[model samples]
Target: MGKFNRQLVNEIKKEKEQESAQLKLREKYEVPEDVMIVEKDNMIKFSVRIIATLIKITIGIIIFLLTVVGIVSLVFPETRNELIFQLSNTLMQLKKFLNI
Candidate 1:
């Protein structure tokens, strides 16, 4: 019975060693060179996309403000006529200023 117990203990120690080796192997991780390059390209693409979105948002805001001003002028007829006259005068002045 003592010999059998010793053999059983040896078997358990061998199994433990094998499990530890497998765990160590599983812990090993590596990133490939191409993966790093792809990550950098993705980052640049995301940045450009963000800048484009910001430009679109800025244009939308400017259009919204112009629409609001136009609506306000239309709601008051006197202001609407004045705004049109002023806009024409401003455009004519700009054309003359640029000699175009």
Candidate 2:
């Protein structure tokens, strides 16, 4: 749809489904300790791994977005000047707020 490749879309969906299945299998079969004292260890491990991965993905996305913005700012003189002005104003406000 909308000039997009259907094959690539299907591939992405398949990959996503595979990852979901793997995560479910991990929860079903993972053993993280020797004693096996902790109840629901597999579920806990799954949850922790999911949360950590989500956080990592979010940070990576933020960095990537900032890099793209920086590149755009550097490529365009008008954008560069406007970004600098806004960034400086924001930084100054942050600095004053932080008493720094």
Give the Cα error of residue 71 in candidate 2, in Å: 0.9
lDDT, model 1, position 91: 100
lDDT of 1 by residue, 1-100 (tens): 3456888899999989866655554555343333321123588889999999999999999999999988999999999899999999999999999999
lDDT of 2 at 69: 90
TM-score of 1: 0.48
Which ranges of candidate 2 are over 4 A from the true structure? 1-41, 94-100
Report the error of model 1 at residue 78, Å. 3.1
Tens digit per residue, CA lDDT, model 2, 1-100: 3787989999999989866666666676784433232234688899999999999999999999999999999899999999999999999999999999
The candidate that wins on lDDT is 2
Worst 10 residues of 1 by lDDT: 31-40
Q: Per-candidate TM vs. native?
A: 0.48, 0.50
